[model samples]
Target: MFHTESDVVFVKGLTVEAVIGVYAWERAITQPLLIDIALETDISRAAISDNVNDALNYKAVCDDVSAWCQAIKAQLLEHLAGQIADKLLAKYSCHKITLSVAKPTASSKRIRLGCRSRVMQRSSKISQL
Candidate 1:
């Protein structure tokens, strides 16, 4: 039977500098964004095997996230968040993903995109590593 119980792997307070926003001034400069991510996956194999190869490689995820953030010229937090979710879900072996994105200098505290329950759909769109 498929395992029903799962574990959460998370990364918090990862700061990414990206050119995000729609305004003229906002588009002109890169801003620092705080990102938090949660991934749901079964790690029983890794736990039993005691091998890094058996586990989810968080370093790779962080590296890819940082690279995508830098490479994407997305204008909105929501859009970027969705793109990130879709990309990670497609690339990683996670069942679900949750993300929180915040502009430290923006008027509001944060913008949260809804959780993605499915992977690789690519309709639209981490971590403190």
Candidate 2:
């Protein structure tokens, strides 16, 4: 039972360089990683007002993601993806979130390694504290 006005706002292909992974070589050097984020929320207020403030602050989301990514070192893309989703849920008012993390194929030894994570929750039920 979802409303038609419920939409997912997103920012994709946000590339940043960070020290990530378990390997010593990986820790010594930074690598370019890309992130895609989707946040689901009711956009009726924003639609009516046509105000950026009334909508999800996408620039703020990107800033938070960048800061979080730089602050932590994760051994796996799955962990990073989960962290991103959790941060979004905790920081913003949203019904659901989906995050994807991708690293270049040439950089990692693992075959086609990437991660995607999704979280769904009711906004009314979420506690602000």
Candidate 3:
């Protein structure tokens, strides 16, 4: 599909509060996890209808991600990001997703650090559902 644009929707700079870190001081407080996600979806119906119901509702996706992020007590950014990717992939049935999470308030110099993960919906899992 060279030069062909895929129907992709994205959510960027979605800041969510979660307890994410490996340090003792970090465990005591909530930190903001900056998230960016791009999902590959079919938006043909939405394009024709101009209806949100026919589209991939991003507000709902944000809410879902927020809820999931806030549920953690203490964790690493890598695991947290992976969990987020898994939840979104299953709920939205997207064929592919690219997710990144960054902890901006991590260091004294504010050196933002985190990980990026990409996950695909397996054919077997989709069939099972």
Candidate 4:
């Protein structure tokens, strides 16, 4: 585990279309969603080497999540957020991951309906759930 202050790699304002929500109208059509993700990692090696392989691959993560969101039908923001968190935590070498999912069309202009989830890789615990 890295005891030093960790670095953060972020993907912001990612837009994707998905089937989500409980209302009849919502279920009938695919709606646009805005997603943000921050992944914690030790960037020391990547920074020094200037190597793409040594760093957290933010593009691949974004692409994977975008594709996944488009493929699944989720009823709530929580479930969608959880699925994204689970996928990233399983696929990446991140120490911690923060994911936010927003349904722009579901809410009024004044508000946004969404959910955020954070998953951490802990040394003391083997089970993530």
**lDDT at position 86, candidate 2:** 79
How do the residues 96-122 of candidate 2 rate in per-residue lDDT, one tens digit apiece?
Answer: 898888887434566545778888743
lDDT of 3 by residue, 36-108 (tens): 9999887778888899888998999999999998885547887777778888888995778899999898767
TM-score of each: 0.80, 0.83, 0.85, 0.86
| Pairs clashing within candidate 2 | none
Model 1 Cα lDDT, one tens digit per residue, 26-62: 9899988888888888888888889999999988888
TM-score of 3: 0.85
Quantify all predictions' global Cα lDDT against the true fold: 0.77, 0.80, 0.83, 0.85
Q: Where does candidate 1 have its weakest 10-residue lDDT segment?
A: 120-129
Those runs of model 2 whose alpha carbons end farther than 4 Å from true positions after fitting are: 105-112, 121-129
- What TM-score would candidate 2 get against the native? 0.83
Better of 1 and 3 by TM-score: 3
Better of 1 and 4 by lDDT: 4
Candidate 4 lDDT over residue span 1-129, tens digit each: 344687899999999988999888888999999999999978888888899989887789989998989777888898888878878888988889999999988757768878898888534443355
Lowest summed lDDT window (length 10), candidate 4: 120-129
Which model, 1 or 3, shows the larger lDDT?
A: 3
**Which of the two candidates, 1 or 4, achieves a greater TM-score against the reference?**
4
Best by lDDT: 4
Where model 1 places Cα greater than 4 Å from the true spot, the runs are 1-4, 108-129
